[model samples]
Target: MSSTWMTTRAWLLMLPLLAIMIAVIGWPMADTVRLSFTDAKLVGLGGRFVGFDNYVKMLTSGNFQRALYATTWFAVVSVTAEMVIGVLAALLLNQRFYGRAVLRALLILPWALPTVVNATLWRLIYNPEYGALNAALTQIGLLDSYRSWLGEPGTAMTALILADCWKNFPLVALIALAALQAVPRDITSAALVDGAGPFARFRFVVLPYLAGPLMVALVLRTIEAFKVFDIIWVMTRGGPANSTRTLSILVYQEAFSFQRAGSGASLALVVTLIVTVLAVGYGLLVRRAAGSAA
Candidate 1:
């Protein structure tokens, strides 16, 4: 077949999918953009156009600022912890040992669990009255009394972070483990023969192979972390004085709970913009890492 015919046929094959995407994603996004410019309610005739009023109000609001800070902190800390724990777990699992296969198979459990289920499990564990965590801590004499973990601002975010890490680190580990498999055994053996210590070997030899894949993992995790909603919502509902309120949670509260569709759409777009910037930045980093690896 001629090249033009092949291209035409490919476009024809993709036309249905493209139409579906436009219907499912494109139309809603365009409508959101329209709604964002008005002062619309969730259930009413669309309100009058308000220009950039919603954007200005949201940007200047203290609530938005706090939510942004909380979201940023959650994303940065959770992603960092996940990456570190994942790499360590990957390294440990990569070794030869009995029952390694069983353990490796078990690593999928947390990641495989539904987000709401995982959040609920953690919520029960953090329950002040009869929580596993509090019970264990008190039994070990680490605490005089069971404390409300999710009820305190000081510890709420940390608790959520830990839960998030548990659910997500497995994904990073799987990615890292796959990358580790590609590292040449001969190179590691040579490094060992050269008396390269574990840290030195990992830093100099293993890390180069892991970098590209880990970068991809990092980008995925970071974006997910930034927009986290369901887990936090299920666990805390951005409670303890909104200490755990993320951008997504804020958007939900504005759009649904408060029924301010216009401002909610504006807030959602702002979040989309932030996520887009992060994705672009991470994409650049991924390219750089790939170029370096090449």
Candidate 2:
């Protein structure tokens, strides 16, 4: 009876949050779906009753294709690198150290800093004439002349990936480290006592324990990475011939820069759909993984 009463109280407490979610999130999604069907303007009146024309134009547009490609590449590569580096960092942090607490706190700086500031710092680091990266490369005899990292089409996307990985991997590392700590000591010790190699033990025990948290991290990161804008905008503005242009950047260019509100909004909703699919897929994957683990 006490447990039943506590459950009832918990549901009552959650009612307000459920209401807020419906009002804020659900209503806006419904509106976006509605608006996508109509011809709307940025600052003017509604143009016409165009059903699916905006979406069709967006799908066929060359710029939108390029943006989709860029966004996909960025999400895949950056998230993969972040997961690998994060797991390694987590392993290292899980071990005992002379100044473990201080190191852990300091490592979070990248994750905690404002995205705009991170972009500014990275932009300066990539500057051709007087940036630190160029100076260091020259000093190391890798290059005879200073060259712009962000100004080159081939390297712009790669450079952005590196910057994003640096900023975000710390978050994954911290979460993984926490999960690693929760791993039982006896099981690991038994594996070591049985003469298992470090890699073997990690493969069999540690990885299984870490899998859930890692997947959660991957899903969250992928969603955010897919929609990234601020850092890219501040750093490169999707310039150097639109080489680094992503879906979200395309939305900005279309809506504000080009003043094509209906087309941009339509394009934006497609991105939203892609992200929603990713999120739903992740949810299903996570649920299956949890069940298997259980």
Candidate 3:
């Protein structure tokens, strides 16, 4: 009887959180799935259930295909760059040095800035006239003239990826650095005593400590990159001939701009599915790595 009472109390304590999750996440997701099967508009009440029409339309559309490709490319490039740069930065910061705390704090400033602010800042930097990037390149004799970085199809996606990497790499660096801190110092010292070079030590000793956290960071950053909207929206609005249009931007344009909520919901679900698959793959990789280490 006492155990039953405790169980009931525990459930009662969880009731408010359960109610909030249901109200916020569960209901909206259910409604979205329901709406995806219909011809719902942005500002409509009733709609006919045209089963699989939206999904079929999205799958058959070239524009949606392009968006998927762009989104995948953005996620892949940005996350890879972030992981590489972040691990390097984390390794650098991990060494004993003067002003390390100050430098570490300063390093986070880019990621600490709001996404809109970072996007706007990068947009201005990439501006054709009187932009810092152009001015620097011209002064350094690397460019004869200011180029429209975000206005060119070839450079728009690359520019966005660079800006995103700048803003997000520090997050991975922080994770990697924390993991590095937990590494067994005696093992690393033993490796050093055996005359292992810096690269060798990192590859064999330090990397094992970082593998788990880096995978988690990769999973998180990949999801964030896949659904990237604000930076692209503010910087290019997926312009330069729609070359930068990602799945999220496509969904936004389809639902709000074109007022095709049903199709938009369907596309959103597709993006979710893709992210979920990627996450699951990463999870399996993490598990395998952990098992191998054990």
Clashes of each: 0, 0, 0
**Which structure is stronger by lDDT: 1 or 2?**
1
lDDT for position 25 in model 2: 91
lDDT for residue 99 in candidate 2, whole number 0-100: 97
**Residue-by-residue lDDT tens digits, candidate 2, 203-223:** 988988898888899999999
lDDT of 1 by residue, 195-290 (tens): 999999999899999999999999999999999999999999999899999999999999999999999999999999999999999999999999
Write down the lDDT of every candidate, Cα atoms only: 0.97, 0.91, 0.93
**Candidate 3 structure quality by residue, lDDT tens digits, 177-216:** 9999988989999999999999999899999889988988
Greater lDDT among 1 and 3 belongs to 1
Report lDDT (Cα) of residue 32, candidate 2: 63
Location of the lowest summed lDDT over 10 successive residues in candidate 1: 39-48
Compute each candidate's TM-score over C-alphas. 0.97, 0.91, 0.95
Model 1, runs deviating above 4 Å: 1-9
Which candidate tops lDDT? 1
